[model samples]
Target: MMNILKRVITVLLCLILIAVAVVYFYMKQPQFGALPEGVRLERIKKSPHYRDGKFRNLEEKPTIAEGYSLVGELWESLTKDYPRTAPKDSLPSVKTNLKTIPADRNVIVWFGHSSFFLQLDGVKILVDPVFSGKASPLPWGVKAYKGSDIYTAEDMPEIDYMLLSHDHYDHLDYETVKALQPKVKYVICGLGAGSHYQKWGYTGRQIIEKDWGDKQEVKPGFTIYTESTHHDGGRGFTSSQALWLSFFIQSPSMNIYYSGDGGYSTRFKKISEKYPSIDWAIMECGQYNKAWQSVHELPEEVAQATTELKAKNMLPVHHSKFTLAKHSWDEPLERISALSQSKNYRLATPMIGEVIRLDDPAQTFKQWWKAVK
Candidate 1:
């Protein structure tokens, strides 16, 4: 009995050591990204929002809401039978060749999720592009829907400014950014997010790393302002090593807003006061759940944020491509469309890769998902 027990213990110890070794090496891979260090870490320490060794939100909300446990949420997400979490068939999309689109045209093209391209006063900007087909560190996780990923890095036009909202996997995919490095001129992201780009071979000169309320003029009359939002980001075990942010672009003809990913807070009203005349706002509205009400806004909060900003038109994003939450993929679109009827903003629901004329407020979009599944 003693001999058998000794053998079992030896085998278990060896297995435990192997598991630890595997994880250590896996995390060492470049995809997990480097944490804020050296000059970047020094800059992060000086931010007004930095507190207790991590960047803090103006509104202090728990990552998971009061009553939920992380383990419970994960179990429910895995075990629960959420109906239609992904479309039953290939989602309908219009692939207007991006490279062929006239450079002079003022437009916005959403590549689904939070990735999008914008041309204002002839300066082209791409935001949070994740074309790696998946949104996780592990290869098989959260794959993009069939037709949603038709747009690749090779298809993109020359990008004057690439806006990386934060360092989260879905927003900042390694494979996607590396492929577009040659065509991209500058990358505008929050304070420490530049660390990841630097590791991926993007020149430090090509990155515009800034704090919460800093502003930059990339082109004549085209100013990009980095603003605060209530979200968290990190690629490795230590999270919120950098600030999470949104952008308010002041173009010569019009103004635009992009909320990368954030929960609902009083910050929206502050943003409206700061940039009083917003032409169009692209807000994050998907992959939200009740437990994460303070992490990503529930659909109701998304509607309220739009109202507070008083945007002339709003394009609801952060949905329709990947399933990060348990809700049906079409739920975000369906809910927000219903809520917008009484709101001040006209909801712009363009199909994936379809060009939307920024000046055309009267343009209409089909309830495209209704026909898909």
Candidate 2:
């Protein structure tokens, strides 16, 4: 009996060693492949998956809300949000069918979460393109509110610029970047995340790193300015080692402010001081909790953020897409609508694929999430 038990243990040890060797080789092989120029392997102290900062409490463990588990939230959201979801028949979601981006018109397509398709002065731009169903390093984690891949690299129009708020997976998707490198003219990101791009085959010319208070000219009429955001960045093993930022996009006829993902701060006031009349403010309005309230503002705070920026129109995003926090899936949008009306701000709340013309009157779609619950 002792001899038989010894044999079983010995085989188990051999199997474990083989599994380790297999995973190690798989990870190392990708490193040696021919990558783009200026792209090289280097270690960074952080990743772009989560918010990290000096005040960020890395040790805090998130407790799933009592009434809202991840699976239960999904169940509630689908019945409530999707069945009542208005079909965007007027807008063509395909990149191949994308109409001529009007030369002087500014169009913003809110792709749920922090992603947007902005066309200003005939220049097409995409922000924080995370089309994956789940925003996790592991496949089995919190899934996107809707199904994934509404559009992919192959479906994207001739992308002139890609603006990234920070390195968070919800913002900066590695697979998307790898596929978009060849087609993208310029990639603008906050400082320190350039290394991740370089590793994935993006060139320095293709990658532009900006710090707060810094601005870059994409063309004569289009300018991107990096401004401070309170969020932190790190992928997995590291924390707070990468820079995070919000951006002010100034085009010929429109000045747009993207809040990225940051808690409510006095930064909006500072931004308004710099650019007094912002035409549109695309701000985060969901995935918030009191514990991390400093990093993600609630819907009310989102309204205040827009007001501080002196924005004429407010588009509440970062909600109606992913379950990043413990709140009811649609609470963020519903609250922000009430807040916007009370605050007297023009809230341009469009559906996921609906287009908001800069010249058109501001409008709000029906509350579709009511159907799910």
Candidate 3:
């Protein structure tokens, strides 16, 4: 019995060692990215949002609500069956040649799941572009929905600025950004995010790293303001190692706000007070659940946040592209659309790759998700 026990212990130890080796080597892969260091680390440490070796939300609450655990969520995902979590048929899309777009046109094109392109007053901006068809570090998982990935790196035009909200795999895809480097001029990311850009071969001059309160004039008449959001950011083994930010963009004629993957908070009230006239608010209205409600907002919360922002228009995003959460692919739109009745802000629901004319008040989009399974 003693000899049998010893043999079993030896086998278990060997298996443990193998698991450790696999994890260590897998994390060493380039996609996991380098951590903040040297000057960047110094800057991150000094941030008001950074303390106790990690970046935090302004509200200072748990990322996942107390009742939820990763293990529980994982088990539920594996055991439960949720229909249309991803579309069964190819989603409809309207492709436009980005380069051929009129130079004077003021428009926005959403590529799905927090990725989009904006052209305002002759200046072009791309936000959280993940065209790699997968939001995970692993090649096979978190795949993009069918017909959702109609755009690619090669489809992009000359980019004036690439706005990276954070370092999450979905928002900051490695392969997509690497392929888009040539066309991109400058990258605006939160503090510590440039470390990943640097590792990916982006030059120091090309990266504009900013704290939450910092502002930059990317062009003579266009400025981007970094602001606080209630979301954590990390790419690999790390958690909240850098800031996740929402952006307030000001052009001579337009003011836009993008709440990058954040939960509902009083920050929206404060932001609205600062910028009295946010003409358009691009809000994340998907991938939400009570378990993680502390991080991602539900559709009802999205409406409330937009109301607090005093936004004239709200474009719901972060859904209809991937199944990051167990809810049906169209549940967000379904809920938000139903809840938006009598709301002060106009709901903008443009289809994937469809142009949203920034100045056109009569622009209308059909209930596109209703036609899909």
On lDDT, the leading prediction is 3
lDDT of 2 by residue, 33-136 (tens): 22212322222223232343322322343334344466765666566553323212222232323445555667887676788888888888889987655576
Model 2 spans with C-alpha error above 4 angstroms: 1-96, 147-149, 362-364
Q: Each prediction's TM-score against the native?
A: 0.98, 0.76, 0.98
lDDT of residue 117 for candidate 1: 89
- State model 3's lDDT: 0.91
Q: How many residue pairs clash in each candidate?
A: 0, 9, 0
CA-lDDT, candidates in order: 0.90, 0.71, 0.91
The better-scoring model by TM-score among 1 and 2 is: 1
Candidate 3 — worst ten consecutive residues by lDDT sum? 56-65
The superposed Cα distance between candidate 2 and the true structure at residue 231, in angstroms, equals: 0.8
Which pairs in model 1 have colliding backbones? none
Q: Candidate 1's residue-wise lDDT over 282-359, tens digit each?
A: 999999998988879888898999999999999999999998988999999999999999998899998998889998
Candidate 2 collision pairs: 47-234, 47-235, 48-167, 48-168, 52-232, 79-372, 80-371, 80-372, 263-295
